[model samples]
Target chain A: MRGFPSDEELMKRCKSGDLSAFELLVLRYKDEVMNFIYHVIGDYHRAEDLCQETFIKVFENAGNYRPRERFRSWLFTIAVNLCRNELRYRARHKAASLEDLLQADPLSERFLIDRADTPDMICEKKEREEIVRRAIESLPESQRMALVLREYDSLRYDEIASALGCSVSAVKSLIHRARQNLRKVLLKAGLGEGYNAGI
Target chain B: MPGYRLKCEEVREELSAYLDGEVPIWKRGLIRWHLMRCRDCAAEAFELRMVSRALRAWGDVTAPRSVVENVMRAVRLRRRKMEEERARLIARILRIAAPVAAGVIALLWITLLPAFYLSYERGKVRPLRDELVTVRVIPQSELEQLVEGRMF
Candidate 1:
């Protein structure tokens, strides 16, 4: 009555230099980790590279993983740290902010739009998505990260705290502030009807 | 529980945590109590809820297939390099070990084997040989007489 090996079990095997187990882990979480990075930094190509780097770091540091820790939280912690470093690098180099960079890349935005919609609808939807992305990017680093982890990845508060290396209370505050900020923006843009009617 | 009531600001602040189900049961009941009577606070909560839904409905971007492919490729390459390094280490050890082993055998033949044989021959075999008896045989002419009388 044995099921498939868990993430911790695969990590244990990875510690013993089992590449197959490492590959299984990669195949399982690659998209999630990549998408998280993309959302955080708003760059697809760099996210791909950082996603690969995250797995490589996990592979190299497999021995450091304790069985008691949640594998998903630990994995996110690595991804978050790399995103921070990338952001820091961008700041240090005076590169354009994520919102501006994403604005310049309309082709990348086009792929995210559904083709079933008419051209006009597609343009409108793309504009809405861009506004949302921009509103997200405008938040402070910790707030943006907390909101994304909770909203997209559906991590528990404790998991978000662990991934962000903060206390649960701090995470709660960050998410609350992030929601309030987004609510303001979404209401102004008239993106969601519930916002206009209810508020 | 009967006397407790949360202020409007307090309820609104913790509303996100309440929505996420991170609040304790008692506080949750209090927030619910406040939202029931306060129209403004209820509207605020509803707005936040809708905001959460909108973000969720923002949809997702799928990770390109190349991400996993490139990751696995890097992992496999590193593994191959590690294997090659181990092979080289073993080869180096053998390269060093083969000569050392041959030298030890040569040294043993040159010094120890002869010394062992000499000691054994002088100490045990020569003394044992000195203590033995000898026997002699009759000539052919005496054999004919021995055949007639069967005496020696």
Candidate 2:
């Protein structure tokens, strides 16, 4: 049975100046790309801007898109590279950290926890979420990227490897190291003993 | 390292892949068996799972409407600007080329075309016998007398 046009086909049309095809590609992957940037950067507004930049870059480089490559990984590679540059720029400037970035923005309360939980539970959940975010931010860049692609995006190990420009075994090791480091951070926060019981 | 400790290290490295189901069947079984017998490995596996769950707790987010609108707007502006730049380039080239083209045509009219016509008429209309008959050389005395009359 005929299904929808694939991403490569849309990309080919985009190369031929089809705006609608480009728009469809944007709509199809924008959210996921935004979420990825948000998780990696720990800031919503920056993620939104970077998401737009990512798509614009894709459009600009449409003529260079190779059909043999997987489009999703190619897209993620662009997003990841942008995230890397943003992080490096922040670091070079000695800018505010993730916590500061979050606290400074008054309208930055987008994370939705369980509604049934009491206020205390909600606060703990928020704290736990913050810890997770900081741990992820503390990881080495490649490790954090590999872990996020694996845990958040659920990309296959091979796909993550492709996006990171590494082998599958390297991806696995990066994820393992990321998790072990997170476990250390969780343990330090006193949440290691029964963290798995229920969050 | 001790034999069992060495075994534990290898299993620890593979635990992430094992949890991800990326390991082969037989290897997965070996890791499973190792985890079953080894308390430390089991705890490590459990911690990794918890970490994965914690990361997933962030949940899915929908891209805001502004993102799409802003992207399309930016793209349209860029494309329009590119087309304008292209038009400006062509106009610039023509601005320089038009006068040069007209000058080349004028140069050909002043030089090569008349020369070509004279050469063609000489070859086609003037015979060698007629050229010999019309060869009346003017005497130097008459030329000088004509110059003196004009001067006077």
Candidate 3:
């Protein structure tokens, strides 16, 4: 078995001014962190930028780290905070509307609909995907983060709470409320007992 | 939706916990029992679960390689900048402190040189004064007669 330094070990080294440890951390978490931010902002470019920013923060704040805590949770906490800041900026600046999300990464849009799909099938899938995306976009920021961290990232409730800067019960409540809202929207979009219908 | 003494609201509130497999065993049993009987709560739980499942179906994307490279480059630049800043601060402190230290030494020399000189002169004169006293060996009455103008 190959031996690897734990994140806490690397973080300790980083706190002592080791840039290599910081780089190692960035390399380790860039993908998942980027993906998390991508789910949040729905823009690959912005998500990638936030990933850089997140590491920069980790690098700068390494000195403040407590070795006893989980490093990944701390990393995601930073990432989540940066994502929230970006969201706040967007809201404050009246920047890109939710419609921008569909085309944020054009490749992803096509990835969902097969080339072999009939026009009607493609249209239906596109519509459903669009509704789902909009429903997600419509979610309150906190709820959206909770749902994203839970559903896509598969983080535990406690980890999600840590990342969200909320309590476990709050995390649960956020997910519950988010699901309730999504259910209402999806059902109103004419999904019935057929919600189990495969996408 | 509370009625007939059934905790429908409470069940709805915790259905998420139940779905997440986080509910305690007793509560899990209670929720399961409630879910078994109430059609409305059951449908609601089912729908929420489906929504959660649909969300999981959202695909994951890989971070671009450039992100890692750019972050590493930026971090290195920041580290260099920090080191340079620290060096500059030290140099600035030295620049300010060196002259202050020199001024303090010069001031101390100026203030205490006379005292040092007087102490040195006193050291030289003290032995000669002692030798004179020993050579004379005059008694107090004799010194008094000399001071009274009597010839020695």
TM-score of each: 0.78, 0.83, 0.82
* Evaluation by lDDT, superior candidate among 2 and 3: 2
Q: What's the TM for model 1?
A: 0.78
Off by over 4 Å in 3: A110-125, A191-195, B1-6, B120-152
TM-score of 3: 0.82
lDDT of 3 by residue, A50-77 (tens): 8889999999998888988799889999
Superposed Cα deviation of residue A144, candidate 3 (Å): 1.0
* Clash-forming residue pairs, model 1: none
State each model's CA lDDT, in order: 0.86, 0.85, 0.83
Give candidate 2 misplaced runs (Cα > 4 Å).
A1-3, A106-108, B1-6, B105-111, B122-152
lDDT of 1 by residue, A1-199 (tens): 1468999999988999888888889989887887788788877778778999999999878879998989999999999999999988987998876567767766466565775788898777667777778888788999999998888888999999999999999999999999999999987888877435644
Candidate 3: deviation at residue A129, Å? 2.7
Q: Write the per-residue lDDT of candidate 1 for residues B54-130, one digit (tens) a residue.
A: 77545666777787788888888887998899999999999999999999999989989888998887899777789
Provide the global lDDT of candidate 2 against the true structure. Answer: 0.85
Q: After superposition, how far is residue B15 of candidate 1 from its true place, in Å?
A: 0.9
Task: Kindly report which residue stretches of model 1 are placed more than 4 angstroms away from their true locations once superposed.
Answer: A97-100, A103-107, A192-199, B86-152
* Model 2 lDDT, residue A170, Cα: 93
Q: Which CAPRI quality tier does the interface of model 3 achieve?
A: acceptable
Location of the lowest summed lDDT over 10 successive residues in candidate 3 chain A: A190-199
